[model samples]
Target: MERTESNGPVTVPALPSLEPIRLVDRHGRRTAEPVVPSPDHDTLMALLRGMVIGRRFDRQASALARQGGLAVYPSSYGQEACQVAGALALAEQDWLFPTYRDSVALLTRGVDPIEVLTLLRGDWHSGYDPRPHRCAPQCTPLASNASHAVGLTYAARRKGEETAALVLMGDGATSEGDAHEAYNFAAVWNAPVVFLVQNNGWAISVPVEKQTRAPTLAHKAVGYGMPGYHVDGNDAAAVYAVVSRALAEARSGGGPVLIEARTYRLDPHTNSDAPQRYRRDAEVAYWRDRDPVSRLEALLRAEGAAGDADLARFADEAERVAADVRKRLAEADDPDPEDLFAHVYASIPPSLAHQRADLRDELREG
Candidate 1:
């Protein structure tokens, strides 16, 4: 046993396997371990299609922000595998709690592309209802959604439901209080939830080095008495494999899990950010080469799973998705500025009613 001597005592170091689990290498070749056989060829093709669409959607959203169609946008350019895997691993009855950067995840969950962007388009709230889709709003605050997820899972279990919840957050969220609180609650209560942390290198401009000194985010799970998975975020198949297994265990009353997907943030944190100030071109180039979409495409070609025409159809569908998003956004009815006043309270107070009436009068006069 390896031991480190402290001034007061000697402590044995843990030799847990910290290497990230990867199904595909950087060159898109399969790993030595046997592949998880559940997701067949058609599933692989579907994953590829979702990833391509996500990439296209990310690009379109960023372009929209640049062109002033959106107020702000977070581009999940290189983290599509993590997003798609988290979304797809859930059953129809399961819930998803996502962050603002998780719009791509919502899209993978069959959310309308335009509906997912409505909040970014400067709407007062997320345009879609949460109950119907079993998704929480795209939260902007760090790690707040994690707490919400735990609460939802707890409530579901109290009702004897077999449902589980998947919580998605970036590496930065791990450092927040809400994250630890949620993790503690989930572990102690044995809540049926999967916490998927997309370790995308940087949280805004703060690199992971400045975030924590932990061996890996997944190691945090050991402290809480739950299994943690360290996986290659760029490997779509790997993410799907690990997340699906975790979700199954959670649904079966196994305690919660923490999954840290090792990935990179290929673009700026948001449209308003200047990533060049904090990171170098060479670093970005390194991650760009290990792109998820490229890796999956290479895998597809290697396996002869999707030929030219099949690939072409997926591409065409991706383009249609992009076009439809643009059109829906262009044709979207402008939000009524006064609609903000209506949503704040179930029953309007007299003072607020007076204020609303005054605003209505002013708008009518103008």
Candidate 2:
């Protein structure tokens, strides 16, 4: 440890070094040897298809928000590789704890596009049932969902269930107390959980440089006594391989693992945020050129795993899904005024009752 020059706290460099794992390059060429057997042609084709759909979904969601359909939306624009791969890594019995920006992951996990966007549209508390889908509500309050993921996995362990929980969070969430607590708890209890942190180079408008002085976010797992994996988030094959191994280990009784995926957010943090406020046009253009969808498409064409027909089919499918998303969102019913008072208290308090009645009367008058 070194002492500070003044009253400010001193800092020490204690974490181990990190090198990100990558299986593919920007040209979609293999960059590293695989530990497990290479994914079959079908798997690669599916991943490519999912990435295309996710990209289209992100674009459509952003357009809907601008058209006054959704109250807000967080696009996974350039990070679709991480989202699709992580979602596909899970088993059917596993649970997913997703953040507001992980709608792509949710859709890949078999969630309805409309149901997943309901909360973002400000129509309902949660649009899907957690019990059936094994997915928690999409979280918005930073790392709060991390704690909930830990709790759910811990409960499953107590019940003697062989299952794991995969949590998807942003780099900004690592700064929160709930994320730290969840990491410590999961590591200590040896809970079956995989934490996938999509370190997309920015926490809202803040850059990774401003977020920490550590070599990388993966080092954050070392202090919690869990193995940390650094992966190129833009490489879908790498993200899938890393997450799949981690989840398999967790369910087999190994402790949790934390994966920090390095990627870039091509779009603004949300519809309300402006990328030009803190990021450059060149930087965004740079990432757009490295877009996951295009990369995977290139690889498939080169490998002969997908032909022109396959590419066109995937593109058409993506457009159809996007159209459906728009139609369903536009046709969804309006929320009832009484819903504001729901799920808050077992019995309504006098103040809430009065407020509910006032809202109902206003609605009636309108």
Candidate with the greatest lDDT versus the true structure: 1
Cα error, candidate 2, residue 10 (Å): 29
Clashing pairs in 1: none
Q: What is the per-residue lDDT of model 2 for residues 124-186, given as tens digits with 9 covering 90 to 100? A: 888898777788999999988888888888998899998899999999999888998999999
What lDDT is reached at residue 67 by model 1?
97
What's the lDDT for residue 234 in model 2?
89
lDDT (CA) per prediction: 0.87, 0.87
What tens digits encode model 1's per-residue C-alpha lDDT throughout 133-181? 7889999999999989999889999999999999999999999999999
Clash counts for the predictions, in order: 0, 0
For model 2, name the residue pairs that clash.
none
TM-score of each: 0.92, 0.92
User: Using alpha carbons, what is the TM-score of model 1?
Assistant: 0.92
